[model samples]
Target: MRKIIENYGSILLLLLGIALGSVIGLLTPHAVEYIKPLGDIFLNLLFVSIIPLLFFAISSSVANIQGENKLGKIIGLMSIVFLVTIVLASIATIAVLYFFPVSSGMASAGVMESPTADNSSWGDRIVKFLTVDEFNNLLSRQSMLAFVIFSFLIGIAARRAGAAATAFTSFLNAGNEVMKQLLLLLMKAAPIGLGAYFAYQVKTIGPQLFGFYAKPMALYYGFGIVFFFVFFTLYAFLAYGRKGPATFWKNNIVPSLTALSTCSSLATMPANLDAGKKIGIPPAIANVVIPLGNTLYKNGSAISSILKIYVAFSMLGWNFFDWNTIITAIGITVLVTIVAGGIPNGGYMGEMLMISVYGLPNEAVPAVMIIGTLVDPLATILNATGDTVAAMLVTRLSNEKFAPSST
Candidate 1:
């Protein structure tokens, strides 16, 4: 049984969460009263792990990347890819909202926040809400960006300090390793947390909630999956001319599976590296691109953020055409979401962050949560594929020639 769970844990837990959530949605009458705490617990648990995990993983990964000679150019191109992918995601989200507008009443009907009489004006409120750290605070109420920034500083200091920071680096590396193990252990409880969270969400919201933005959500997810195929095919055509795409999946499926099972690009690094090497990607290219990909290749999560923003705007009856809002949403999504693609269970947290930033209706929060739970697997697949694509793209950008036996 343990072996079975280990093999099929993520998928099994995800399904069980959905089934339980749906049942709860179907049967529970006052889901808001009882389900809130459960959602909070799951989110809290997930958030507590994010900062530590990101700090060590990103700092260490970045350190390893910069050690490479052509690292500057590689990092630049990867950053561009990350930005462009996020923009595309934002566009896809806006398009979904425009195409299938969910009624505002669906969100406004049931809840109430005490109206403020001051009316300090929308401009003032917008300015405050749009602050960078404010959005981070909204999600986990922790300073994720600060933590990441500090981690980078520590990594740089470690390299510069030589032996002084050696002991520190060793400790951090060990902490990261231990935390990874803890993550594995924490994931064992995902089914229970997800089940409770889902049950609470669906039990309270009911199936009708799905109809609001379900079509658009599906479209967003479909676009990401389709991109994976398009990118893989393009890589095949470019690298091997007419025949490469045919064998791309054959050599890379194991990495993809590992990515799916693990729900992390970083976690699947070994496999991705192995697959890339098998396909003639050199150690130089693999070493540089794979790690950078972890920080700047969140095509899946980016797309989800875009879609969620649109949904939120639609539910709030806000003009979706506001350039400032659109631009800001895209910018935040791009910057914060770059590395988030590889994070297990990150999409939901991302949605919460975006929603809070926009001051979206509280009623719509559960809807976004439900979507996150449902789409985690697809998100995992896209995150993995995005990394592979980045590796190929970065290699091409760096003009690195791959030999048939390069691995």
Candidate 2:
């Protein structure tokens, strides 16, 4: 009991926090504002950490991988698979959300002011949009594209420096190490943060929110799992053949479970690396893919985008957005997921800003935040499992592609 508690301490704490918050909120309704500040503190802590964490983790990983010649093929194959998986996950999420639909027809819970100020004039809005950095500062403070562009520039410079770049590379590597430790510390506080957030949500929103919202959230999570199986597991079976899902699960399940239980994909890295090797993926590929995948190619965030859109349509009874809107939403979600995947708590602010860009009604923001906090552990499980499967399949396909040409 003690061992299990120690092992799963982070997840346990998160849930405990939620449970406590719910009870307190139910008992003292007026104190909701007091607990709300805790949520703010938690979110601020997470936001401050995400950008630096993502930049170092991804930039350093890229620099290290460049030292290996075979990495190009590995990256190319993995990127193709990653893109396909995200597209499929997006489709699945949208389809399931459409079917399960979270429509309540009820007005939003409170008299909340619009987060956005009046865009009364086209010129004013255009001016704001044209100066994107200014708009982003107003919106979320952290811009995903900006982060990616910055990281890409640093990574390119590091790669070009060759032998001379060792000092910079070491700095990034050290940053990664420090961030890993800091993430663990934050995760330990997850229960408290999640609990406060959860309690505030439950107290303010009540049980009806779940009845009205749970189906779509469940559909979102279901799509994530379905894509993990279809894209990752199915490809593994085709590539491995004699060694199928059974074998892949045998090798990767422990780490997947660890990721789910702990809700920290970074913490599960050593386990995932070991699992990848056990499943017959080369050590070089495993080392390269798992860390990089953790930094990018987040399958779960793709599903979140689909789910968020669906909720917006259902909640506001807004006119169905056009195909261009859908495509734009999916595209932005994919880009943000890649850039922000490495950051602890990066998704919150990014997605908050995304709601407006996608033309989603702001009423959906609280619902999305709730989903982000609750669904994290399960999402991490699906992501890690999917990544391992993709790595194995990519390795097997690369081997076959280069094999002797029998004319």
Candidate 3:
């Protein structure tokens, strides 16, 4: 009973929150509005924690890479694989949207004010991304992409610092662990916080929020399921042919289910590691690649990001076929998705980047958040399962012999 609750508790709580929130919204709209602050406070807490979480988690992971001789090769190969998969996923998203376009009726939804001014040139935006005032950017929620870049450089420098880096790396790792504990504590209160927020959302938008976004949601889930089976199978074949494909499915079942239930790839890491061992991946490779991949390889989020951009463009009546728009959409999707971690609503930062980079209406942020929240389980399953697949590829490419091993 304890084990079952431990596995399913969070998902059950989330569903309960949604159901109760909807009822309150319908029966007591005014009261729901009053409860909105609880939700706002919860969201603000999450936002405040995410910057430091990304910084320490990513930098520490990078700083801990053990094989100095093989580090460059391993990281390069893993990155190539990650980039290729994300690009393919993005293309799949574009193709899916092309076939089943989002409804223009989304324009009728209430538009929030666009947050940033739209006068910045592409060159100016690029410059700002690379050279923001570090102290100021650290405080602003909008600077996550820059923050990730800065943290990554710091991590690499720490890796090169030899024995002197151990203390700093230990500190970052400890900080990351503390943040995870904080997240768990927050999650325990999520039912109340999310319930209040959802109630307010239903009150403001009416229950029609679901119907308003139905078509795009359908597209997202439909394509997501298709991609998971097809893409993972292809990856299995590339890693080791027929035998590998069979092992992939057999090993991934538990991790896939955990990811789906938790809606969190990071939360699924233990299961992924177990699956990696079952499938004969070397522990050395699995340990390094799985953690690193959790931070960097986000094919699932890349697909979701593409869909968000399409939905935003559909709502705004932008020309999707424009070359400049297409390039920007794909580029930012890849960039933001890389940093999209496994927390619920973790993709919010990525959505903000999309809005800023594409000059999207700030109102689109909430819509994207709604979409991400609804489809998080599916996205997470793909993200978590894909990490194991990446580990397999990395192991095979590195010429690491697959001997069946368990912790």
Question: Pick by TM-score: which candidate is best?
Answer: 3
> How good is model 3 by TM-score?
0.65
lDDT of each: 0.59, 0.62, 0.73
Off by over 4 Å in 3: 1-68, 111-210
Give the worst 10-residue stretch by lDDT in candidate 2: 398-407
Tens-place lDDT digits, model 1, residues 198-280: 55545433444365456655676567677677855775666565646755665566556445434555555545555666666
lDDT for model 1, on a 0 to 1 scale?
0.59
Cα error, residue 57 of model 1, in Å, equals 11
Off by over 4 Å in 2: 1-69, 104-106, 110-211, 343-345, 400-407
Cα TM-score per model: 0.58, 0.60, 0.65
**Residue lDDT tens for model 2, 291-365:** 667657677777775666566666776644468767876787776566444334445644655665766565666
Off by over 4 Å in 1: 1-69, 92-213, 235-244, 339-341, 404-407
Better of 1 and 3 by lDDT: 3
lDDT of 3 by residue, 1-407 (tens): 99867655665776687678778888988787678788768666756766676676557767776777666777777888888888889888887788777783566555444344447786886676555765776555455456666776787899999899889988988986787677667666666776777676567644543677888777888889989999898898878767788888977866664565446665566567667877888655665577667767887788888888888777777778677888888899788766575565587657767777786666666667676666676888888789889988987788877776532
